[model samples]
Target: MLDGTLDGRAWRLNDRYRHHAASEVLRRAVGDPDLGRVALVSSFGAESVVLLHMVSVVAPGLPVLFIDTQMLFAETLDYQRAVTARLGLTDVRVIRAGADRIAARDPDGSLHRVDPDACCDLRKTVPLEQALAGFDAWITGRKRFQGGQRATLDFFEPEPPTRLRVNPLAHWRPQDVQDYMIENNLPRHPLIAKGYPSIGCAPCTSAVAPGEDPRAGRWRGRDKTECGIHFIGGRMSRRKVTA
Candidate 1:
């Protein structure tokens, strides 16, 4: 449990670390006794290398949670392993949707065609919630420039179930991510050069052209922008809740 209430602690810490750089923000969050335990949630996508590199520098052994929705692109899986090895991340944990759950709800593996929101709930959101149960705080790679609900992204925010979200790169821009990856010699996700600015599951993700939103390819032709992870509050009720 946190020192005080979870929301209370989150508010205070968000204020304290708002002005700090990503490295310092990460260090303080991991070492913060009040938060109990912390973990990093990575999609291992296009801009993920920047934040993962930072975590490797500050706390290599810190738990890194990767949600393998089982519907991800083959290259994403390969890239996950490659990046983990390249960055020397010590505690990379792969969390997945239960086999039984998938068999029951999506035996055909085509649920995303009918209701993408339900697919995300069963494959990503619920599994991640289970993985995060042991952690007091979790970190994400979301940035303000990502647009949509992420336009107001902050360094820290209090999420539901009393957990704090630490967005170390909340203020980082696209150029910042590109420069960090180049300077650090990080391996780029293979699909990036193939026009995929934002990578997600194979079926729901596509390639974007120049001048398109980095996330424009995700859930394309649909009204969905997120896969039910970063959404908070009443937004949860708006989706098909299979959890």
Candidate 2:
């Protein structure tokens, strides 16, 4: 059971520990106005098919936001197109960093090397915040096993002050992801077979060494990890949630 505290208070998951039942969460969220405005953000990365497929099954027309960092691999672009069509996902929108922001803040494109946090704010966070302006909550594919800041993920918790974040696969193992893919005959990201177990922007990701953390390849050799696209709160400060 998820009995841990969140922000010095108990976290609730719709009155139960929602370690399974993606369909239940999907249906419930979709049936309510505040929650139904929710959208699924996908990277079309190594293991995104699980959640993407789940969302498709529950609501094929539900909006799915895909952040095209413009620095991603060609394979990922193709994969995104192919997967959406195959799953009959009717509402997949491609979002990107505002071109003006990129030109003004990161003209040379090496901002990530010198200041990853700021780069992420401009490239990933700001646009995502704008894209999600009207949402009450959002669904994430995060799992506890990713083992960083996610060790205590719950089924339903406050993203902060405004949104009720939902994570249906919080307790799933890597094997669970595999089982879902195999059971459903889902298409795999081509880069996964090329040793990029986790995918992100091309410049930040590389093939990992044997036994390295699955996310190690991302932002390799840098003091950074997440691109901050799915950050819990404010685009610039990470201090407030806008839902």
TM-score, one value per model:
0.94, 0.88
Top TM-score hit = 1
lDDT score for residue 112 of model 1? 99
**Candidate 1 regions with alpha-carbon error over 4 angstroms:** 1-3, 237-243
Those runs of model 2 whose alpha carbons end farther than 4 Å from true positions after fitting are 1-12, 16-20, 33-36, 230-243
Model 1, range 123-142, lDDT digits (tens) per residue? 99888888887888899999
Error of 1 at 107 (Å): 0.2
lDDT of 2: 0.78
| Model 1, CA-based lDDT | 0.87
